[model samples]
Structure formats: C-alpha cells, structure tokens
Target: MKILANDGLDQSGIDALTAQDFEVITQKVDQKDLPEFINTHQIKIILVRSATTVRKELIDVCPSIEIIGRGGVGMDNIDVEYAREKGIHVINTPSASSESVAELVFAHLFSGARFLQDSNRKMPLKGNTEFASLKKAYTAGIELRGKTIGIVGMGRIGQEVARIALGLGMRVVAADNNVGKASIKVKFYNNQYINVDIETEPLAEVLQESDFITLHVPAQKNGFMIGEDEFALMKTGVAIVNCSRGGVIDEKALLQALDSGKVRFAGLDVFINEPTPDNQILNHPKISLTPHTGAATLEAQDRIGLSLAEQIMNLLKNK
Candidate 1:
C-alpha cells in the first residue's frame, strides 16, 4: 500500500501512519507540480489540501490512484465529478472540521462586529492618546445577543453556526436550495425558510431583517450566488460572514457594498482568490479577513488527517 501525503502533517500523525505499515511518501508539491509528483509516485492514495488543486490534469496522471482524500471539508480543490467518472473515489473529512470552522465564523463575527483587527492596528500608532480612543470607537458595536442571524446554507457547518447563534441569543433563519421544508432543532426561530421563498422576497428582506448574514454554500464559477443585485438589497449597516467556499460570494461586489455602507462589515474566511494579496478587503476598515483558516485548527486538522487515513486504508484494503 503506497500513499502520497502531500498535505503537511504533524510528527505524531506521521508516526501513527508509519505504525499502520503503509509506505507513505511525503513531499511538498505546489499546485503547478502536483500532477507530475502523483504521476511519478503511482500512488494509490493521495492526500491534499485547498492549496493543491486536484483537477483533471492530476486525475489523469494517476492511473493506479483509487482515492483522493481531501484533508478538510471542502472538496473544492478536487474535481469530484470528473474523478467519479474516472472510477476514482473522492472523500473529504467534512464532519471533522465542523466545530473548528463554526468557531472561526464566530471569531469573524466578533472581529467584524467589534473592529478588532483595525483597533489592533491603530493601537501602535497612538503614543500619547489614551486607549480610550479605541474604546469610544467600540460604541458602534452591537451585542450578538438579541440579534437576528440568517444563514444561507444549513449543512453541518451552518447547523453548528445555528447552535452557537442560539447560544448567543440570536435568532436564526436558514435557506438551502436542496433542502425543502426541512425542520432544524435550533430554538431561535419558529419558522423554517426555503431557498425559493428566500430569493423571491427581495433579498433585502432577509438582509434588513437579519443583523448578521453568514454564507456556507459551495463555490461556483458563475461568480458566487451573491452579487450587486443582492448587495443592493441589504440594509445599511448589515454584517456579512463567508466561511464556506470562495467564489460563493462576489469579491468585487462585496467591496462595493462595503464602500457604499450596504455592508457595514464583512468577515471573510475564504475569498475568490486563495492567498489573496493585500487587496481592498484586507485594507478595508470594515472587513475582517482570514487566510482561509476557518478549519485550520489543531483539533480539526488531526480529525481530518485521521479520517482521511482511515478512508484511504479502507479503500486499499477493501479494493
């Protein structure tokens, strides 16, 4: 059983895999060189992260590969449908990273609502002025308690968000295109919303009604599901959070909305471009950005690694 672990792993994890008697080849392959490395190894299982894209080129190179294991939830890095067509299995450790990502959503919520990043930045510039300057600015913040939150996708991560939101005393409304009339157990809202209805009622209704809106849909190339038309519908001073896949929300549209005050603050854990340079979102005073680390916590990483390891081992043994 030969495996290629391209995603970085802790020493403990590597030792555990060694104990499993699998010959694991560890290498650092950037996106450009991933296909060649896979081709050279003739690996049966390849582990990867969002940094390495497992597109058709990589898939085509690995004739012996049986499974492509994504170390985290989002398989956005892999061409899942194409892999399926090629008789290759794609597995992701979705549940493994749920809590970590959900917590990151809240971290963004806190930073976006409270302007933590900017305040931290401005602190060093102030020499004589009291820290009270930043304290006064905090007055614009609103408590998460007693706020209405609308979640666009209510999958595992979204459901976890709803759990935390309810704990914080925020009301929750969810809409997913696939799930129709399904009921969730969170006590924040009495009514369940469907995607069709959510789109019809002028998105602004949800924006106006919700103090915070967090998106958790998968990425699509059609320029995200949210755009100028949807942004125009948001209430002034609305806060937006995106921790799902990149490209699910239009970056430029978000910038314009932030500038116009249609979106008061945006907490973005993912972006249209991975490792996005010091762009407007990073420089924007009202936006909080992370380097796509929503599911990068130690616990999440270990869970995902172990999950992927098990799945790969299963595939090799069963096949």
Candidate 2:
C-alpha cells in the first residue's frame, strides 16, 4: 500500500512503514493538486499534521484512500466525520504528544510568572545600559509553589500538567465534562513517588479558586469554551495558558481581561488563525506567545510518527 504524507512525516515513521514494505511518500503536494496526485499514485493512506486540509471535496475525489492519519491531536484540519462516513478510518496519536504539550504549558507558565518573556526581550536590547533598572522592573514576580492551577480539561495532556504542577508544589484543581476524577503520580529525582487523587470540580469553582488557569479542551462546534462571562468568573490577576486547539478561548475576551487587569498574564501556543494570528495578541506585552509549537519537540515528533506508522500498518496490512 502507498501512503502520502502531504504535510511531511517524520523520518522515523517513513522508515517504519518502508520496513514493512509500505511505500511512504514524504512530499509536499499542492492542495489544488492533492486529489490528482493521490489518484495518480493510488495512495491508500494519507498522513497530515496541521497544514493540510482533508475535506469532503478531497475525499470525494480520492476514493482509493483507506485511511487518514493525523500525526498529532485535533482533527480540525481534517473532515473526520465525512471521511468516516465514506468508510475511511480516521486515526490520530492523541496520547503521544501529551507530555510535550504539557511541558510547553509549564514553559509558558514559568516564563510568564518570572517575567522572562519581557526581560529576555528588553535585556538583549538594553541590557548593558539599564541592567539594574531592568532588574527593578521585573522584581515583582509570582512563584508557582503553593499556587493553585486550574486545568480546564482533565484529559491526557491536562492530567500530565497536573502531575507536573503537583511536583512543583502547586495545588491542582481540574474541571472536565467527561473525566470525573484522576490519579496522578509524581516522581522525584530521588526515585520517590507520591500518588494523589483529584476530583474534577465545577468550572465556576475552578475559575474562582485558581491562581493560574490553563486550557486543554478540544475545539467547540458552537463557540469558544471561555469568553467574557467565563473570564469574569476567574480570580483577578490570574495567569492563563492555552496549548490546546485555537478558538477554544476567545482572543477578544482574553485581550479585554488582560487590559482590565482581570488576567495578569497569558501564554498562548495556539491561535484561532495559523501562520497569520491576530496582531493584537502577538504584539501584546503581557502575553507570552509561541507559534503553535506544543508538539514541535523532537521527542514528541518521533513518538507521534512511530505511533501513527504502527497504527497505519496494523490497519492496512490486513487489507
């Protein structure tokens, strides 16, 4: 079987598939020509990250495709329901990138709390000229220990963040529609580990109680998960982080909260628009921003690729 990895697949995944006698093509095909290319190559499976869009039009034209594999979580780029309706298997490595994303959430949280984002920017520009002045500017910073972090989604990624927070001595509370409770185990450098049970609470309670809030929910079909009213429920000066899907948080509301001092700081890895995010959020001094790189780490890419390759092989090898 032939597979087309349009948005590029990791070399590990390609090697794995090739080892099993599956022809894996890692080429950039123009979106307009994808249908023809798939038809010409008779590709049975297609793998994508976030760049490519597999919609009903593409699926309708490429009838030979048996599977659509997303290297990471979030199938918003793919027409998952339509693909399934056409008898194509849709798969994603939801668990593989959880640790990477969870780590990024902290990367933002830590940097934001200590004012690293601002200092890193200003220090380079005027470090020698205004060393002590910059220090005074960043002296008032928050510490993570003993602070409460509210996780909006208690899925794999959210749970991993909770474990990390607990290890750092931060109190963790989570709210999830599906998950009622989770057991998190934190391991120390000395090989000692502690297991803690946490129950999901009401969104309002978590919002009102947390010192910092991080979002890890899936995309909403109707609208944003958190908007003006939700922000109003949060404690004043609460820091916010989002590594989940874009559009989950209302950017407008976030900006307003930041301006009104309802939100002290924010770390955003995902945006409503990719490659061309809103300039308001990008230019905000109080927001520590990354370009949707939650799953860009090398380790996560390898795991995602290997997992995707294995799943694809298992499903297609039988046919």
Q: Which candidate is the best by TM-score?
A: 2
Q: For model 1, how does the per-residue alpha-carbon lDDT over 43-83 read when each residue is reduced to its tens digit?
A: 77777888777888778866888888888777877899999
- List model 2 lDDT by residue over 1-319, tens digit each: 8999988888898899899998988889989999999999999999999989999999999999999999998898899999999999999999999999999999999999999888888999999999999999999899999999999999899999999999899999999989999999898888999999999999999999999999998888999889999999988899999999889999999999999999999999989987799999998888999998999999999999899989987886686
In model 1, how large is the Cα lDDT of residue 91?
89
lDDT for 319 (candidate 1): 72
Candidate 2: stretches off by over 4 Å = 189-191
What is the Cα-based lDDT of residue 286 in candidate 2?
Answer: 88
TM-score quality measure for candidate 2:
0.97
TM-score of each: 0.88, 0.97
Query: Model 1: runs farther than 4 Å from truth?
Result: 10-16, 127-130, 181-205
Candidate number achieving the greatest lDDT relative to the actual structure:
2
